[model samples]
Target: IQQKEHPKFKRKGDDLFVEHTLSITEALCGFQFILTHLDNRQLLVKSQPGEVVKPDSFKAINDEGMPMYQRPIMRGKLYIHFTVDFPDSLSLDQSKALEAVLPPKMTAQISEMELD
Candidate 1:
């Protein structure tokens, strides 16, 4: 039997994928939330402290996906892909505060520029 749609997750084979969006601060500082699984189970999807999830990064929760066809107790993996939403710009005060908490920016070196 084949099903058409699901409210929270998209599936492939037995594996499930969910696209999660996080703010820049959340991505950088780490994120945590409860996800409603395919079987109506609430699962914790979290990142380690100080573990920054960069834009378009992926995390996985094993044995949390759909159950196998014949083996009702066996399940696949749940994959979470993160999309970091960064603001276009920050105010001077905000920038300063962020700078203080973050590592120093890496500077690029260049000698000269030629315009056409």
Candidate 2:
């Protein structure tokens, strides 16, 4: 039987992939959300403390994908692809705060000829 396309999930064999968008703050800090599975199950998805999810990163939930053929109890993996949504612009105070908390910026020296 062919699988129907889901609004939030893409299936390849038994594996499922879903894209989740997170705010910039959520990516750097922590985030939690409920994911509705194909079986209509509500899964609580969250990031660990101090665990930063970079853009285009992926996380997986074991045995949470489609049920394996001939094995209804067994399932494949569910992958969550994370996308970070950054603000178009940051306020001066916000920028300063980020700079203070993040790693120090690297300085580079350029000659005047390089500017030309």
Which candidate has the highest TM-score of all? Answer: 2
Spell out the clash pairs found in candidate 2: none
Error of 2 at 81 (Å): 0.6
> Residue-wise lDDT of candidate 1 within 16-49, one digit each (tens)?
9999999998898878898887667788888898
Evaluated at residue 114, the lDDT of candidate 2 is 97
CA lDDT of every candidate: 0.86, 0.94
Where is model 2 more than 4 Å wrong at Cα?
Answer: 111-116
RMSD of each: 2.1, 1.6
What does candidate 2's lDDT look like per residue over 26-113, in tens digits?
A: 9999999999888799999999999999999999999998899899999999999999999999999999999999999999999999
Structure candidate 1, residue pairs in collision: none
- TM-score of each candidate? 0.84, 0.91
